[model samples]
Target: MTRLDFELQFARGDFLLAATARIEAGVTGICGPSGAGKSTLLALLAGLLKPQSGHLHFDGDTLIDVRAGHFVPPWQRHFGLVFQDGQLFPHLSVRDNLLYGYKRLSPAQRRFELQAVVELLEIGALLARRPAQLSGGERQRVALGRALLYSPRLLLLDEPLSSLDERLKQQILPFLLRVKTETAIPMVYVSHAQAEVDYLADRVLTMADGQLQPSLATRDAASGLARGSAGL
Candidate 1:
């Protein structure tokens, strides 16, 4: 099913982002080199940037329609975003950081419990520590747990593992895979790492010069990765 339908156009200075896409459930990975406007597209989907003219629909719900002068704000969109840097609150303990957004929602709106997310990410031991006290991978895991605890309808991840070393990336990949398999939450993953995208994305798209297109090669790679990882 089409989870997100986008026909978006936005411009800043000389750069113009003209993109149309139908993102289905599961992970849709956006891969492109630097300056390809991948991040901009994510921002638009996150409702952080309003399109000049276009429509964005999530599950048939209109998120934005330029013609109607309608746009949903980021907080109202129910999208959980995890950026490259982890972006945790420096002073907040890991427990508080996870509770930040989770607490914002009324009990009725809460979908994922704190204990489930903590155990899912295996961050129970780190809860008492602050962001500064954790390692890079541990911090990212905490960030992921925080996002999941928000019970977001969609998760947007932008180069989440880019800052980590190869070993750290390996350490975190399984946790991400577990999230995909266990939570079943739809995700839009943006990264320049082809291999990472291939391993995690069910569908692959490429963004370049403000345009989005399917990457056949990446799609094939993803298929292979899925087959290979089935036993794991």
Candidate 2:
């Protein structure tokens, strides 16, 4: 399994984020209240945001080395991101969106079997519909499928279930669990809810005051108050 190691320092206005952690295979949950830099950290990992100074290494491969003036672009990182909003294109049909990233990949680069992912996410029937035609849960499933179809080395999820109702949360949680047990890809899941962390994460990182509180195993999380800033 590939391990991602990052030591990033970034600041915006009065808020400062300086933290370092190693993310392993399986889901590593980043839990904290709002504005705790969870989203910022994920964005840095995905290369959507550059750190003021730091280095990011994946499985010993250098992705970003600030001192060396090296940085990998977001698309080249091969890290898939799913936000709270599905972020699907309104003009595209479900099939088109799922195929969006997959289509860009060269044939040899395609690691995920299209048919397999389609069945895994149960999105085959929704292909004909547009984004507006699908429910919130259905949209998230499609989003997940699209990301997986790209054959990403790592998956980044930022509060993907936050917008869903209780019923939809229950509906989509199984798919997430399946992804955890059924796939080899590693994931970094960001959320403020302890229930989500308990449910989906094999390990947990607590972020507070724009910093990582401690690198604690999930077992320790339940015993203490998960201290941190509010959501962003």
Candidate 3:
């Protein structure tokens, strides 16, 4: 099982984050308005942003230790993150981009098979295409595929659907559902829309003013979505 144990306090310009959270194996949704520190939280967990006082651990591995002057770097943390913008390399083909980070893994440690990924993401047809040639949804899918191929212990999705229109979002939601159902890794999804949370069938963690609240108190399996469909 994956674990996230983090407590962070840091400031940048007018923004400050005093956030702590624990995530287990499954999708954990973080929903809040733009300034609620959604992306910041993800950055901290990814080791891109260091907290003045906090400890971050995944499973039994210590990712960050402030007291000992220790902070394992981002690449070593085994985190795969999808930024709001699809950060695929324009110079590389889809296949190459997906396999870019895969070379770091020893052959025995490569849990995700390449053919399985191509079939699951249906990226085979587009493998030869460059990033600049892809549609918004396609680029996002490629980005997702790339991150997944990296064999991350935990995945962080920062507003994966933020740039897409409603139709595009609808088109892509199923991919996310497939990710949730098929993969065993825990996902930390950051979003501004509650509807997206429900549509993807994730456990919701609402954020406000740079703090994460207790997880949602519902078990209907459809509670988060029911509220989303009603425009909550």
Candidate 4:
């Protein structure tokens, strides 16, 4: 019974994430238009950015309680983030990058094994290669591997495929589906692509102009209604 509850408020330049959400041990999608604060919410959860007024918690662990002026360290939180660009260490071999987090965990808690994840993401052949040798899709696969290696309490994926070409997206998306099916790790997949949301989300949250909107028929369909000239 994993749980996460968060409320955050902040502004960077012109974007803001005045949003709240709850995740109950399953995949949840965060969908929104560009500049709607989707990534901002993820940053808050990961403790990479703190809010002006808010609190974050996971199963009562107290990740952030700004009211008490307490903030937990990001690394200690075990938040696994996979960004759109797939930020792998350019200098390290794929194997080293994946093993980095594994080495940090005590023997008892390490759940992700290299052979399993490497096979799952089809990265066995890329292990010896540096970042410069792989395609965009392959790089993202390695990023996913690194995140899984951490054994995260929650996975924060910020529009991971947004930067890939359509051809590469085809190659990578099935692997993501495989990831979702094979791992119990709860994920917050951020995307503006309704198609991706439709295929991957168990639940969806839609954001626009820093505010979250609810949809009885799902956001992609509801958004269609809001955009149509026809009266509801």
Identify the leading candidate in terms of TM-score: 1
Alpha-carbon local distance difference test for all models? 0.88, 0.85, 0.80, 0.81
Clashes per model (N, Cα, C within 3 A): 0, 8, 0, 0
- RMSD to the hidden true structure, all candidates: 5.3, 4.3, 4.8, 5.0
Which segments of candidate 4 are over 4 A away from where they belong? Answer: 216-232
RMSD of 2: 4.3
**Candidate 1, residues 1-232: lDDT per residue as tens digits?**
7788888999999999888877778888888998899989889999999999999999889999999999999999999999888999999999999999999999999999999998899999999999999999999999999999999999999899999999999999999999999999999899999999989988788888888877765565544332111012
Q: Candidate 3 deviates by what RMSD?
A: 4.8
Q: In candidate 4, what are the lDDT values of residues 1-232, reduced to their tens digit? A: 4388776787777666577665666567778889888888888889998888888889889988888999998889998999999999989999998888888999888888999999899899999999889888999999999999988878899999999998998888898888888888888888998778768777677778887654343544532322211122
TM-scores, each model vs. reference: 0.93, 0.91, 0.90, 0.90
Model 2 worst lDDT run, 10 consecutive residues: 223-232
Off by over 4 Å in 1: 218-232
Tens digit of per-residue lDDT, candidate 3, span 106-217: 8876879778878887878998999989999999988998888898888899999899989989988888888878887788888998888766634677777876775463
| Candidate 1 least-lDDT 10 residues | 223-232
Between candidates 2 and 4, which one is better according to TM-score?
Answer: 2
lDDT of 2 by residue, 15-66 (tens): 8998777666777888899988999999999999999899999988899999
